[model samples]
Target: MLLSGELGPGDRLPTERELSTRFWMSRNCVREAVRTLSSMGVLESRVGAGTYVTDLQPQVLLDGSSFVLELLRHRNVWEVMETRRVLDALAASKAAGRITAEQLSELRELMATMDSALDLDERIAADLAFHRLIADAGGNQVLAAVLRTVAGGTTAARKRRGLTDAHAMERMHAEHLLIYRALERGDADLAATAAAAHVAGVEAWLLDTDDSPADQ
Candidate 1:
């Protein structure tokens, strides 16, 4: 209904009993359907009124994606990393051509912050900010939203292993510098390559570690 235009933003949904009868489903099944859609941000419920279709914003719809990724990380950590690798590369490539002067300055500042960070957590925060700025510079809200969720989903795995080893941290900083230089030069291909390599390095380190996701 939503895809076909039968339902739209602010359109009130039929009562559960009505939907149950029309679809030949039990009321409990109808209720569950409504609940699932609500969680996906496709529907909104009011206290005195009833359920209605939501605005269908990308950010809202994708809000739960990170949680889903986190829940499945134990079995699909590698796949999650692979997805991030692809998205981060694409983001970097687009950002190379589209990034503004202000964004570039911000990236430079973030790099400095990472270099001077006194603690692991502070360094990690700077690292995340650098990637997020790249994503925002790409000029695609939907892509940014999805990439943000994928990044968040992998936070636990990264925290567990990616930044712990001194050698790995040094290598990652070098890779980050390469990515920044590529972006600074507006070289889309190099930016993509550098971003992909950085993420691949993280994957390599995680794979070599025992990386017991059960603990994550």
Candidate 2:
């Protein structure tokens, strides 16, 4: 699409037969790819018409990451969080250059909601949404998708551990605000540093809990 100027939002895709021949892959492989893309909201199928490229909106395509994360087992959650921290740090760096005023406003709104959330579940939801907005602003679709998946897994693990203390919540909110402020100043390096610090705090908290009396 970028190369040939033949692809754009809502453009009808070539038939499976055509794609299979073009890619020199089995028809089954093409079908599977189409199915996965459809799930990711990258492609839409109209029964009577044909499959077509979607709107390419960040939210639509990135929503599939949640489904991917939902399949992770308990033991994988820590690894997922580590991945999230790395991705989020990179996203903060990129977003410092690419983030828009509208994205910033949305992130602040989510932060406000987080401040007012009355329960663990609500706080978790707001926290996830806040990070997701940062990912979307990062200007990298693949990275945003991966962040979403890792974030989903991390949220699930936090819920399971009953780790939603007031102190933890307050700390998370403060860290998020710091990162947002850094991005507002268009400081990629500072934004990355803030993000790294935020996730590292969470990782340390998780580790501390692992060695607490309750765990024993």
Candidate 3:
């Protein structure tokens, strides 16, 4: 029914028994099917209310990958950044080619948060949102999924590093400007280059801050 458009996003699904009756299947089968769809982020169940269809956006569904990210601790930070660099660059390149005006407007709002917000936490939130917006707009769910996982993996490190350095924050705003400008111009190559540079700068910072005894 979902595939046949008998149900649409935000539509509340019938009770398991109702579905079983409608489809001539057992209630257990209906329950299992609902559970599976819920895991896939296609169906959402509310305890008191019942189940409904989800928006099914990739970003909304891919958060489950964060558990896998936790298991990637054995991977080097540079290795992770290397992957993000490539994925983000490609995502940005794609977004530049096809982003809509409404999406641009949203990006500009995030940029404003990064620019004028005095709270470091707010600024960082905007920073992450800006990056995610580009990837989501890229229209490639798989790339967005991988990038979100890689990014979710580093979120703790970013907050721990703090955003206290005034100069660094300024540079961050500038780097975001470069990327957003490229995106506004619909320059895929330039967007890719800027995205790569943004991630590369992050890698450089991580290397410089290496506080292990070997470096000490």
Candidate 4:
């Protein structure tokens, strides 16, 4: 209600007693609900001023997504990657149609930076940024939020697997370039194909490495 503009930020909520009576619910239930929303950054309680709607920024709402992804890291690596691939493929398809020329140029610049990023940490950061840019180009906040969570999870999983390598980085650069080119040309099919192929390449490499003796 608050986020949808039914209630505005800084607008004080009704008193607990009034809420309980009006809603015909126990005060305890309302209190718990408010507490949960507060924890999620959807509501704020001011000491005497009363509770009000929060700013409801994307970052605030999606903050718990990272933590959830982290907890699910080891349990289903392949599943996580599969989910990411699907999301990214959809994002790429949409971006091909929706992205602006300026956004395409920005992606080109990020790709260029990734080419020279020799350090593992730098490569990871650049890689995440590239994917995030694609999500942003899709022009959907919910999709972008989901992509951020998956990207963070992928980073965490890569650290645990010790999977960063020069070859992997090179492959990523090439794959990203292909996807960017497709989007630049405004070819939705090609963009989606490139995105899927890129993710599949990573999936194959990770699986091959996992089966290798050293991974055991």
Give the per-residue lDDT of model 3 (tens digit) for 1-216.
Answer: 988999988999999889999999999899999998898789999989999999877676787777766556335666666788899999999999889899899999998887888877887788788888899899888788779888766665565455533367766778889999999999999999999998887767766674531221
Which residue ranges in model 2 land beyond 4 Å of their true spot? Answer: 1-9, 13-43, 53-68, 160-166, 211-216
lDDT of 4 by residue, 137-177 (tens): 98888888888888787785454343544476667778998
**lDDT ranking from best to worst?**
1, 3, 4, 2
lDDT of 2 by residue, 50-154 (tens): 999998876576676676665553545556667878898999999999899999998998898878877879877888888888888987887887777677767
lDDT of each: 0.86, 0.79, 0.81, 0.80
Poorly placed runs, candidate 3 (over 4 Å): 1-57, 73-75, 160-166, 212-216
Stretches of candidate 1 exceeding 4 Å from the true structure: 10-30, 210-216
For lDDT, the strongest prediction is: 1
lDDT of 3 at 185: 99
Runs with alpha carbons beyond 4 Å of true place in candidate 4: 1-11, 55-59, 159-164, 211-216
- Separately for all candidates shown, the number of backbone clashes (residues 3 or more apart, or on different chains) is 0, 0, 0, 0
TM-score of each: 0.81, 0.72, 0.71, 0.86
Q: What pairs collide in candidate 4?
A: none
Q: Candidate 4: TM-score?
A: 0.86
